[model samples]
Target: MRYIIVTGTSRGLGEAIATQLLEKGTKLISISRKPNEQLIEKAKYLTIPFDFYSFDLQEIHQIESFMEKIFSNIDVTNVSSIHLINNAGMLAPMKPLERSESEQLIANVHVNLVAPMLLSSAFMKHTKGWNIDKRIINISSGAGQKPYFGWGAYCTTKAGINMLTKCIALEETDKEYPVKVISFAPGVVDTNMQAEIRQTPKEDFIQVERFLTLKENDHLLSPDYVAKAVIELLETNHFDQGGIIRIDEQ
Candidate 1:
């Protein structure tokens, strides 16, 4: 049996991924600020095993214990593999860095970068003895590779996530059981995050018009489409460790 833990399952791509996995009969544990009612109802209707945790990833200090509790609840017997999808993120404080508030900057970093790192570390440490297949999918963005005006915090944090994936892969090279990791850029998706982007003022985001046009022309990819790609990556046997994979490229 495969066990997968996905973050940001309250809505958007994370919710779509969790829903698909449930239909596939995998044991799923989802984390978000609030539980997705649709997922709960679907899991019940299908008689599938589902665990939902309402967690604020910004609480970095409690992550270790939180992860421990999650693992403790699972019966690892007869488990084939475990996977982590670091999908929770925020694109807030979308303004010039100099004009951004200190609290918002720190919060963005904590949610986007710090929390994923801490969660990955805890996952590796807790599963150190398990010799099963382990994998991590860090949901990254194109912004990480290319800078956008007024997206200073978001861009920097995503770049950090890419590097973090590489660093983890490098460290696991000699381990008897290495957790395969990959950074995934889902491209422009139609989600609440995109809605926020479209709302950005021209002064804050010079490319605001470009995003507005994308929405107008229906150029954005659907969350379900991107989620399917992520699910494919999870079930596939071949994965490039530390590689940055893009949905558009696939």
Candidate 2:
């Protein structure tokens, strides 16, 4: 049996991926701020309510213990493969750096960058002795690779994740039971985050018009489409063959 853990399943891309994975009969553990009612009704899904906003992710030992408790009941011997999708993220305080508030900046960094790092470390440490194939997918963004005028915090966190993926992949390459890792960029999907971007005033987000154009021109890829593409990539040998990848490229 295959087991998968996905974060941010409250909505958007996370919801899409969780839905598809459930349909494929994968035993799923979903982590989100609140429980997803639809996912709770599904047979193989285990929803864990985790509020990343309030949690102190820097407390590594505590976080590791929490993750260990969550996975303690799973019979690792029966699992053929295990996957972790670090898909939780946020795009807030969308404004120039000079106008960005300190609290917002700290929150964004904690959620987008720090949380994933701790979770990834916990996953690797706990599963090290398991005999199943292990894989980690960090959901990244185009903003991570390119500098967007108003997305300083978002861009920096994503860039950090991409680099983290590279470093983790390098460290695991020659291990006896290597864990494959990939930082995946799911380009321009029609999610609530896009809606938030389009709603931002020009004064705050200088490139707001560009996002509006993408929406108007029907250029935004649907969440379902991107989720399917991601799953396809995950099921193939191509997954984790490299440090960073784009869904559009797949």
True-structure RMSD, every candidate: 0.9, 3.3
lDDT of 2: 0.82
Per-residue CA lDDT of model 2 for 91-156, tens digit only, reads 987999899999888889988998899899988988897777788889999889999988999999
- For model 2, give the 10-residue run with minimal summed lDDT: 46-55
Q: Candidate 1: give its CA RMSD in angstroms.
A: 0.9
What lDDT would each prediction earn against the true structure? 0.93, 0.82
**TM-scores of the models, in the given order?**
0.98, 0.91
Q: State the lDDT of candidate 1 residue by residue for 1-250, as single tens digits.
A: 7899999999899988998899554899999999899999999999998999999998999999999999998787857899999999998799999999999999999999999999999999988978998999999999999999999999999999999999999999999999999999999999999999998899999999999999999999999999999988887877889999899766
Name the regions of candidate 1 deviating beyond 4 angstroms.
Answer: none
- Best-performing candidate as measured by TM-score: 1
Candidate 1's TM-score reads 0.98
